[model samples]
Target chain A: MPFEVYTFRSSGKRLFAGKNTPHFHAVYGIIAHKQTIMQDIQTEMRNRAKELLESKQAGLVVGFTLDEYGKPTPAFITDPDDVGRLVWNDDCVRSRHNLVGCLKRDEVRKLGKPAVVVNAAGKRAFNVLIAESQREPGDVVLIDMEPEPRDARFDERYAKLAMLDTMSREERFAFWKKEFTRCFKCYACRQVCPLCYCTQCIVDKNRPQRIDTSATLKGNFAWNITRAFHLAGRCVGCGACSAACPAGIDLDLLNLSLARAGETHFDGYRAGENPDTLPIIGTFSVEDKETFIR
Target chain B: MPQIITRQQLLALIDSLLEAGTKVATPVARGEKAFFQYLEKGDAPLIDPAVFPVNSTKEFFFPRHEILYTFERQGTEVLVTDARPFVAPQVVLGARPCDAAALPLMDRVFGWDFQDRFYQSRRENTTVVSLACAAPDAGCFCTSVDLSPETQAGADAELLPIDDDTFEVRVFTEKGRILFGGKTSESDKTGRTGAAPDRKFDAAQIRERLQTAFETPAFFSEAAVRCLGCGACTYVCPTCHCFDMVDEGSVDKGRKVKNWDSCQFALFTHHASGHNPRHDQGERQRQRVLHKFSIYPEKFGVLLCTGCGNCVRGCVDGLGIRPVLEEIAK
Candidate 1:
């Protein structure tokens, strides 16, 4: 059975309900196996963090630590001995969270170099940040979570997104409209995205007031659209934004649409796939395929 | 003497209120989480005391975004129309006692200087019915903030679960009594408050530390590094009531509105002169603690936080008040 893709929140629910197609089945088994993976990777992560901090290879280790509530939370450890707090788990909500984004923060910057934990998607976004000139490759170290290179694991990212494609355009619009209505402009969706590392977000600007500041349906639509478009060709499909939304909006679906387009329209170009290659958005191609464009 | 109503009767009560043209807000299950939303016909309200809504009931009184007024230009003559605050008679059902307590704590702020009719009107028109916590999670710290699962600070009435079939209603105010008038039958079986949430910190100690910790930046910045600087925690909180006002729409014709703002945002204190007193996220974090513990309490004679634990639950970064306060007390 193929592994179903999603966070512990929705995935556990759907798995318990015996829902979703059987093609993406045994998500529970995969999660259990992922825990076994955690045992090995957690040891590896702690070792790497310890090495980085002890040798001063990195001034800070941005990783996951269990909070008092036993939830996997983002932690910053500077002391070499504190590396034991580091962890890797299937439910590490911070697993896909691009801890690399923390390198841009003042408090984190004051600590010198950062050694960040990153899954495939997090690594992709890290590369995107570099391509966009928001970061330098030398600025932070990446400790990859995947024990081995597995594009098949990344394939699970679009399992639910594939289901959404069955809906008509009107149905899609209605689906999103209802979802956007719940948004109260908390900006959790924006704050969590690695690609959305804007110093002054468009929503915050009031000089010309690019978008409505209200949380009205129209205003919310505007906000969500702005957030989605801004990350177009750049979003790494990390699911952090969707997981972060207290409104329970599945924002990753919007990113999936753009991500799939990035591969198709840009001749199999993927954001942050290669550090040496220029970004699809930043560098335009004369051979760029487009049916919609005149 | 307390009055009793069966589970079926309580749901019927919600339907009856909606049928009678009264707006009702309750936790309605949506996907994996529950949210406090207005109930319509056939909408199932989560009456279970264990279900904590992701968003607060504060929006019922102080909406996320509300029109202050509207204006238009007619040649040399200017015209203005004041936005009448929505004051429809509403019933907030199945609110946690901690959430209910936020109302009175906030009332002091809204009604202190200039009676904010927007909030005061809703406060006057609504009756809050809180469900006494039968099952409190680790996130809950209501007991630490001078509130219990059955605290009646702002609730008009309190519901106690006798079993899956029954609830004992304890009326606190005249408004609560009138709302439940004739709906309940007198019963000797009192609803239990259940186990109290284990106290996480002493509110007095936090307030005391905050008084001196104002100048100490490390205490706050320790947590600030991980804070994502989003409005999630503040918006979900029952008592975090900071707002930004702006004229929305064109200059010729538009409405002035107040929208929810958060101290966590970098721009919350950004000055017109490009100077900010709260220099960093650490300062902002400090302000949040000091305001809830020291500033508001010094002014209102009560702690600003009700310890509903929504902030902890809603924080995307998993950073919240309890952890910070506990760190301080330790």
Candidate 2:
């Protein structure tokens, strides 16, 4: 779908007269839901956008979409009558000038008054009455529409797997073993995982070949067990690893199994519940249960 | 009739193959430890048919620190440089069954939505020659993961140690047959035919045992408490595929690199905004178990563990998984 980009221009005054033009330059593109922008915002935005898109807001602009290499693409509007066609593109850019003209003319003719402006930034300084000043280029004009918050239930489901600690150990083990055996050892599970961003790995240390270099059954067992244990109570259950596994290994089962154990043994707790909280292992409480101690 | 090479002849074959332009890598003895090392003609060591290797074979396909794409910057302009293509076909000898199986698992991740050309290229060009296990370790349980010492899940050719000096080599793929120069002898082919040992416990029995173990407080409290939260097991595992991605250099210009990651570390799942989800050894321990037992199986319809027992031998605190499984099996 095409997106309309609106550049605000005030009547009787020029916003862009010279090289140092004061015109407001805003680009709008139809970003696909679940596409990333920057690391953080992109992650949240994609989750929200995907929800909106799935709910049938086909032409809605959930947020800005990024390119294949995860870079932001510039967008602009070129058509005035096609204002309604503005939709989100994952990383594609469109002209904004054309979109704004179409949106303004259409609203003025239909509503008999000023059109609605949607301000993504929600800046209070730009909250001016529609008719107060002639909208000019670079003017901090507001869009009069309110975009609903995007729902991220699917992505949320991934994050919520950390809470699946109610299952018994047998259930957990049966589940994870099948999942891990499918592992191809591709670093995608590590690459796409936000939690796996370490500077150096213990396995790569030359001082000791802590882990061996062959893909033998013994090696695979050691690696997967170590990985699962490492992520135990701390895993946020984003399921990014499971999603990223090319062999279709069920990485979430491993994360969830650990989450379940932590909850049962340590007062039913899981990871990622509080993004601001410390990991369970890093923090020790006086009331920490040590029943397992001999 | 295919030529039947004796163990001495096989070693000669390896030497000749190494001499014939291929880079041969095989398990070499380092003091008491064994690891895969590049061979120079006469130096390739014999395959260890009793134990599995500790490390994954990913480095051969995807090097630990590979230059994905190098770029040179010149005053607001940047020129991208392609990485050097891998030269020479390599043969991996003495790989275990579970190790061989791991290639396809890793292949799925590398060839997923975004194709990793470097990994694919190496996988395509290299030849893998695996060995069957003659003796299973105390912690070895490939049978539990639907694999056995004789399972040729992902091997091109499999070698069974018949005696100290003779090997029964079975070619499973076209690449292996070509490598063996179409060596096909009826006696050689029929000599190694045998079904894998029937694992005593069925899935239901295992599940029941695991369920009972989970119910008993001893399983979780006893084994998990001793874990020092070090990822020694993962670092040495062949199938554990977790990794971390980082960028080196300043924001002006840098390259993103991927490194191995272990869940045992406290900061593994920590957020950039100063929050960590898995903060405790217990939680981390739980994650380790679940990832292998539950989450991985849920997605892939198979257990992630190859049952090679590296984790059992690698852990410092003796928080090996075998005892835990044995308890669960009880």
Candidate 3:
């Protein structure tokens, strides 16, 4: 034994309590008492995963599994009977990443049809992919994370950005510089993001390299700014970029800044909302205000 | 030399090190997590024995971006200058033993066929002072790879906590001895280190499977599917040293710099002729497992990993070496 470590299992009962009780309690839902709700979600997840695989609706079901820490990890279920591996819970980062984005990966695509978790962010991601002809809606079977879809995450994402709105550009630059310095250029933000499904990212290009690939503060600043600007109107407000960042950077704030600009600055535009409509960026408005250019 | 030091004395020593212009690197609290970073004066070392910093200690030795050399062209002659061949003295305090153990494994490669002067310089100048772990998380598997919480493989000094305020210090190298010559006092009470974590997998079995099972791709069959192909795991890994060299400035005055690279990148093996030997993420993941268990071990007579679980903690979904090893061993 490793000197009594805390362990939280799928069962609601306590497994092992160690010195880090308060921390484990906070993470493991001992405080929330969410057993009943989580159990229901688990059953639904297994059932949906099983049905998708059995009915040939999906060859794979991308769901959740509890890791060694009792935190959610990705469970890619290819066998219907193996849906037993799946777990379900709230307070988890959605599907370990963007579900819509996973469909584009060659490994996942090789598995045939994939059913993936879709929360508020995922639906928008799916919608954006559809509009851009990146994926077909029929190809994916969505596992809705909420009983009633709410934009709580979306509201919180932009709500935090209101402080940035009040700050001068210099203060804002300082704030982001402090955050960007922590980035190791791991690209977790890009990997987890559904909208960032390009075969070749701009930073990876070698011929006449557009951005400095070094993890210097200046390089990070340019990369982050370019990343935000590129998704000016196409981000789905998933918050996965922020969730997946190991450096603990507020990447959501950067994306939300662009999300806000897409709405308030560009004629109330939002991405991944509707597949039939055109996006704000690619579509030009001749009668538009060009005052910001000055 | 004294053999015991109170927490206050340790803190004062850190201040002294900083005062003497020696770079002090320690795990410092960054938001909810602690990260191993070079500390400025007055910056407190986390000192929490249980907390594993969000990053490994490798970056302090082999940084993310370093100038290999600078070049200036004049007519037919080119003047080349090596950058930062000698590093200032530094101390790494509160490193996880697993992180410390990795230094020896890395030293093998860094000093192999071609000596990496950049890594060698930093390694020579830094003294590793590792903290014995008392509360390892479930993913930690030091025992599985022949390491323990207090393993002294790469540490210049070891600090075993006797209580909330004192540690039983043991020095291994001259650098460590010089750093703490008289700072500690002998104490009758010695600190106890945690027993090795429960062995998670059979290393010999996993290594054999990796050596023979290239066609099957057995263990990481579908698990690698969930991989986001991000550098998080490799970057956090203490022994995963892959880098790319690129010229920064224009032709006239450019510096050749080496930037950290990961095998998980889509273009890591993409040849100019458009052939990628590691065709997919699954193959790339297979390469990682093979290198750690089969390839490197065969060449060097030691496993390339320290079982720190940083890859698991840092990965997008906690799918790292342990899971694959455990599955293959089964």
Candidate 4:
């Protein structure tokens, strides 16, 4: 009943070879082309497989090749020489869909059937495959996809958005006001938002009626602004709130504006990346930059 | 001339209106507790004009639990059906100035970016009749905020109690005028003498007091340690607008509903990866204050509070905002 993991890799001829292919080959294996290259790849995969097998790390190894149309072919090789062609490349293996597609091929499936462990990416590959056709945690599962970098930035657009650094106070206020005025207080933005989920809101507190309940222009303005400020640097820009608002308010603008300000004011700190990182207002650093503070 | 009824006569008129097929909702006493309830033809004994109700009029416009849309699936295919729309037109009577003032604030959020047809439809059809405060409570601080006891900013028709029984009705909008149906007389006088002499406090002095309180060293330090992190304050607040969206039932068939949410809960900022951004109560409390005092004022020209004192009355731990504001003002 334990979960099992399976790893897979491609064993096709190189249609295009570059830095990624070399990087991939360094970890997985080289394309089975010249005898020398094939021998080198075989030596590497064997060294890796031997290390795992000796340590009782992985249960199986599955290697594959591709057809002329870039589709996974039915040909596979467990032999170290053939397995040597399975190299890792960033560009070639960047997508999960591509790896999954190649693994589902008939020839690859056969190789994967008995594999209790898979080393799909070649570098630090581990996944468990159970005997009952299930998956386990320790089983090494591999696919022909590029491995994530240590400090990779997921969205480059956020970087670009963070670079604008030229918005004035008036411009920022106007932008936020236009967006906030459209709020309907349906709380869809707050509900779908991962950041705004509090058990009891201060606005709802009756002890002093901190915020009014009768949804008005003034009240909505206060509520929306307060929400945006609380999420100032902490928003991950998931766009969940904007997507969920029944009022069609462009809340992303408010969040992004603050995010942009946070970047401009503070050395471009992003939220949700480091759990240990304190909020912008929570901690004060001696080397903190304060050009934006008036 | 149309009848100028006393308080009892007005109640009779409300009963007659209910008898004539109009849905009338007013603040009614249910034992010790009072809430806005449906006023039937013979519920005269239940109507209370003393204080603002425990519950808000938001339910009449937007119910706590409403089915936004329903989905039914046959095999792998799914069909989504919109829920029944809001159509009933009702009257909200005996609304306080703060509660009445809250309607426009709610409208901003609902009408901004997206138009909430359900809330809009109910709002467009309903008439709000508010009552002026005869005597203000120590906890009542609407005057300190952006409103006053007699402010009729959001009410369709404002009723000022002149004596023990009679009231001078002031119609503020066309809707209010229409609701009177040419029965009520109009007067040119801007101000009328009624109720207790209105206590006058300098808006500038109140603002100064608030400004001084915010500078007090204990304001943040005291609030940080005492708050138990419960949501009772936000839930009872006239302006709190946090909510949660949940899909009830099976994936094949279910309804997506939005329910009221509070920020005091630890899980409010919990991430899918088991990380919470606002993990501590102090941070949450700081967020509460900054949102109301600093951020809201910066975003909107007005402050978020109307000084209804609900939070003062509802706080279980005596960590009420008035003391906090007083500490801040000190």
Candidate 5:
């Protein structure tokens, strides 16, 4: 058989020939311009990281950069010269769960102070860290990310939670059971979670195993429900579990459902907010009223 | 005999399979994507040739967790009972060619020294009816792995969609003939075959490059630094067959179960003496690449990847195998 051939219009030639095709030029031109702006943001972020490291304001700066595959990923910058590796884009959300765990490390404490690059969502996790007395506000530098165009897909999942709620009990049960069957008990959801930073998880305790470690349907359900319950009043809705799940399970629904229920019943107390405010789960008052309890 | 079946007939075929006490599994469309699932009797099968199911059909053969045996302590004597595997006949309808091909590649490992009864039994009972992909994505590289959308490496039958409502079925085995009930018509055969897609990389070259690639620790570290040590890639993979065995239940009464495990996890290689040969993420990542491209190919004369692109698509970060292989080629 002869090798099938495809007509070639290389990117370089396309750029030059794009004038002949106005449609291609317009689309490609906008994309190229957007990329340039993104690169500028990344360059500025690197400069900021370098300044923080040089000024001794932060012994270590946690940032993100594109890897060899051009995938945005988290990076811990200690040397000023390495700051050029930092990047900022749509995919540059830092897992605050990792930062929370890092702050507790003895080596990190020995380094004097840590600065972290975070978006508005990540700042909520910092509030939880402060409220839990994990770190003092002054002990760390918080580089708040500028608001960019938000991806509506995540918010769309929250809306899908409503769709899930509309399902009958049997339908919901069947849906969750089918979803849980794909879970391999990888603990990636727990690993990626900023709030699930326990040195030893409950599932690891074999003496009186609270949840089975096997990836059986029953075991998966138990693991998922327990993990969700553990973060009921504290999950910052980072959507890390959903992103990390290889099975494409929308675990954000479970967390968002709890968050919605908490908001409705507990005077709209949100997790990852001002740490000074008493937590809904921990606080009790005679004024606390709920119709769902009855 | 090759035959043509309308989309409606395909659904009816699935219905008939279920009616005959056969478990027919296929990719089921949810909203935006599809998942491999068991189609109940009268349920419609959503075989989207464009979309690869999130979970592979590997679970149909080798389950995530299975009981090997159960033990009970009675009066000082321990009573052990071997759990028998269920060996019901099944059909996998409209599986991706890449996923179908993984079955035979995995067979080498499962059947090498000692035959895995559970996997073997499932393999023996199930007939794979793979659907050739109409459109391969940037992540898809079945051609690079010495397989293609129409390779039929592990399939008993192949279905080529000629249009939105029609498919040309090609039988490869007696099992496929049995499933179709010898109702095929030679006159209806289209004589059409799947077009060859663009090759992502050369398999021979990748295997050769993988030999000395392990020496470059700096390259591996740079490639794997973003890895969160997650099992998403492995779990979704059609060929990854690593398993961990653990006993569950009370100390007196328990069942030894095998669960899916991944080398990406730190605990997968952790030794009791606190020594791990694959200690860092980079080393672990290197092992994974080596296992698929070098070690498996050296032993089995076949690459351990079917190039379904699940590892690339399922990765939490954009840590893709295609790009990693490209780096090795460089």
Candidate 6:
């Protein structure tokens, strides 16, 4: 009842329309529609995870669940009984590749248990591990994800990128300058990213301090550009970095712009599509499709 | 003296401050979350403080990045020029009470050895106008730390929204009195205050349990297992003041900048020879709690936390301090 003040409007009317009203019914209908879709996917995911955990097929099932704050967070369920805790929602936008990437470490590998996720990110991360010689194909188990609509929560992410694309060079500069001003160098983007799995991140090294950790205008520009450039062709486009950022920086745009450039210049070299495909920068082709290069 | 001011009068005060070349920071909605940013001249600030902002008012005081000094090579001579702290007079309007209370706790650390002029100057320059929180979130535990919605610890002035259009302004300091500036009219409702939410957690019980917490490694380890070791919790925290000084730009021509640092990171304690006293996640987690509850209270007689719950809200894994405190109390 303490939160009732939040619902009460300035005129003392409830913020939301009355439950019996058409407006309320319509809103409830939309919510119910979305919930039904979510429930369908979640039930299947939970059942599969439960089966895997119970059958000893996987040691852990990396999934999503609501935290105490009602925010979706990564859940590591080892017990079949705990599979009920797993959920599927728009907030679970993180690419599970990073979770799987942890298994490659010797400390985590010693646990001797496999992990499963119903997504492309986990599979893509596993492929990157294989590409890096950390693991071979079939070393990890990835269940085929159900047909879910592309998360619309990231529409603003793409829209911002599009808006930046339309802006003049000076306008673009000013836009990014304002955005980068919010950067705190928390490294949440790098930490959440599956591909940014360097044992010693360049920002962390101080002997030759590669990138400034301070979130100053010059320092942020340097650090952000370096981070985006590093993942040019390799980024999985999972939207994890932008999703995890507490600053709300539109980093997805940076990655997406680079991803588009990689696709255009490298003859549609989409990252995380095929495990065997040579990385755009990793291999040189005699029949390279760089006719635009003067 | 406590005074009454209409919502329009408050808005006009903010407008006048902006017109008079004073930087006014407020919680402005950007994208999905509201962050504390300096309001532009025309922008109307949000009246509801919304419990707490995504980013604390700490940014106005101790910025995430600050240039300490710049060095330039002038043909065999290195020229150094100190970067003075920006001390322009400013106002933080509609600051959450919990966030306002954190300023004094930060003042203790920044003023301890070498008086950090950057933090001290901002503290002196900025006048905080805090709005009493009407709706406390699930994660809020300000009452546990001896702070309430009406607790005016660090705020220059406090305002309680009586209804949609009026606010009861209570000036605590000379800075606040000057900011109000005779605009507030005398009204019958002078000393009236907002209703505070029920106490969320038992602070005394938690404090007692923490005294003997160090001996119990198992308790901390259990909590540490879920931690992703991300700096989200500390960076969003109101009182986490640890920082790292590094030279940005080239050795020939660049600046020495101080960046906010968190103990949650492995590198926070890593030495040149690869020796870390707080190696494990459990130890690191223990240090954070102990510092907030034990060390801070022992030194400053105030808990280091303001219970703003930004850490809880922004935590990547949802590792809230309330549950941890509850566990310790148990």
Between candidates 1 and 5, the lDDT winner: 1
Which candidate gets the maximum DockQ versus the true structure? Answer: 1
| lDDT for position A96 in model 3 | 35
How would you encode candidate 3's per-residue C-alpha lDDT over A47-68 as one tens digit per residue?
A: 7678778999888887777887
Supply DockQ values for each candidate: 0.63, 0.01, 0.58, 0.01, 0.30, 0.40
Model 5: per-residue lDDT, tens digit, A1-294? 011111113212221122422244356676575455456556666777788889997888777766544666557678899987777654563332234333443334455677777664566676776666665666667665533314345346368687787899999999999788768777778766767767567876655767887887889999999999988878878776876776668888899998878867767777766657566675556665765544
Range of the 10 consecutive residues with the lowest summed lDDT in candidate 5 chain A: A1-10
Model 2 residue B245 lDDT? Answer: 60
lDDT of each: 0.81, 0.52, 0.80, 0.55, 0.74, 0.74
lDDT of 5 at A134: 60
- Per-residue lDDT tens digits of candidate 2, residues A143-208? 312232122354343455644455587976655554454343434455334344344554444345
Q: Each model's TM-score?
A: 0.92, 0.49, 0.91, 0.48, 0.80, 0.86
Better of 2 and 3 by DockQ: 3
Which CAPRI tier for candidate 1?
Answer: medium
Candidate 1 docking DockQ = 0.63
> In model 5, what are the clashing residue pairs, if there are any?
A97-A194
Candidate 1 lDDT by residue in tens digits, A256-288 = 888887877767767887565587767666665
Report the TM-score for the A-chain of model 5. 0.77
Chain A TM-score of each candidate structure, as shown: 0.81, 0.43, 0.81, 0.43, 0.77, 0.75
Native contacts recovered, in order, as a fraction for each?
0.76, 0.00, 0.69, 0.00, 0.50, 0.56
Q: Sort candidate 4 into its docking category.
A: incorrect
Greater lDDT among 2 and 6 belongs to 6
Candidate 5 lDDT, B115-178, residue by residue in tens: 8898899999999999878777657888888886668789998888777787888889988888
Superior by DockQ: candidate 1 or candidate 5:
1
Let me know the TM-score candidate 2 reaches against the reference structure. Answer: 0.49
The local lDDT score (0 to 100) that residue B99 gets in candidate 5 is 90
Kindly report the root-mean-square deviation of model 5 from the true structure over all alpha carbons. Answer: 9.6
> Candidate 1: deviation at residue A202, Å?
0.7
- Tens-digit lDDT string for candidate 1 (B1-330): 768999888888888889899999999998999999998666798988778889989999888999999999889977999999777899998888888899988899899988899999999999999998877887888889988876788899989998878999988899998899999998888887868887668889878877778775566778778788788889999999999999988878999999999998888999999899987877888889889999998988889999889988988777888888888888
